[model samples]
Target: MLTRSFPRLATLRYPLVLAVALMATACGKGTESTAPAASTPAASTAATPTDTAATPAAATAPAQTRQPGPIVPPQGPAPVLGTDYEEIPGGQPWQPEPGKVEVVEVFGYICPACAAFAPTVEPWHMKLPADVNFHYVAAPFGPEWIPYAKAYYASEQLGLVDKTHMALIDAIHVKKTLPGEGDPVNEQKIADFYGQYGANPKQFLDMMQSFAVSTKINQGRQFMQKSGVTGTPTIIIDGKYRITGGKSYQDVLRIADHLIAMERAAMAGTPAAAPAAAPAAPATGTGG
Candidate 1:
């Protein structure tokens, strides 16, 4: 099980405050990926520029995204510690089981960046090597974001995340069902969206509020805080490294794949693949 930091009451309130500022700062982080880009939801639009040069050709034209890319070996200098990637302070990656490396994505349905990053993450996650274990941790940034996280956790309990993951994003970003801001989340409407996926509205709604799901949400919040994740779409590798190359959404995965290779080798007792030295302090930068 994952560990939590905040007390129950305070944890519930923190997301409301942090979410407000996060949207503003996050605007400066990544590209907004949507059709007829001008109409992109305000929250999902890219507010600032990142290193799009690192965005490979496949990401530029997602039509070819499913084509498997070459599996480059992890060589050359390691990613600059404390810069490219930051280590969690005295923390271990939250692995689900032995024989697999943990990959947790911190995202929010309301985050435009997360919506934009979804396309890249969706196909990429499926192609991951067998030794890597991937996870999605929804950010409970506010009243709007909290409902999505609750829904995601509910899906997790029902073994339906794969079924609902991209569909939720499409409903909001593509169909424009969910508002970007200025309106409270409509639970019934969101429930209706899930209903189409065969989730009984009552059962799904009840699952979201179940004690078990609540605990997972709390644990996710604590994990974000510990790992220096300040926005949607941040990635934590093996609970130790936060991919911070800040190149592009695609670069996030590129760096993560490299880290996975390194971790994989280390697990094999390869002395040449020593882990990066621990950082003196945990990163204070946002995961944007």
Candidate 2:
């Protein structure tokens, strides 16, 4: 059965079950309460079915919020518009920017899926052309994840994401240090984790609580709210397409590459590839 209810744990987002259950909750860490949609699939019966079960037709069906698709690897064609990806109606209405396609990822430090996804997307991101600008926006789901969000903003302010992004994920998901067992949020340990990257533990700690850090965190939360994302590691391409390709994280990147091509084609005034039939409405949990 399709599970749409958010889990009660701190770690938000579902496992990559067939790529659908992504937004359905209790992910690896599991749990978070709703602030509100501020915006933001279909019910698939095959709990363990193929990843593409949420095809065009099913996508038109009204689904409960947070319905998680399955976690199967993506073994399909490049994502279909209005099905695999949801176009941000009204044109990324959130922020107005110029040039350079934007690829934004809504993620959390406590999300194991995000941790696993980092390796998959990072290498691909490095290869993208200058027209694409990629970055991450930490999701402030709850207390446990908010601190990590703070850390992310501070690190970004310090210009250290490339330097310590992997290390931080490794520290939490692998090294198993960095505090926060259940709902615990520890800044000291997180600061210590960044020490190896030339961050002064004291300055890092202070930065985590600084006004500038708070401002960035707030901005990130608003952006996430505007993003209509309820799951971690959601890849949004050029602010129009959200790469929720079913199957593998690699498929997400593959779809991203294809979409990037489409964007480039559009920019050049060339006729774009045929789009998948538009759904009756946008698919929220469906995409992420």
Off by over 4 Å in 1: 1-72, 75-77, 273-288
RMSD of each: 10.8, 11.5
Error of 1 at 203 (Å): 1.2
Residues 112-206, model 2: lDDT tens digits: 55665665556556666766677888876666777888999888888788777766766665566764325467788889888877899899999
Cα-based TM-score, every candidate: 0.71, 0.71
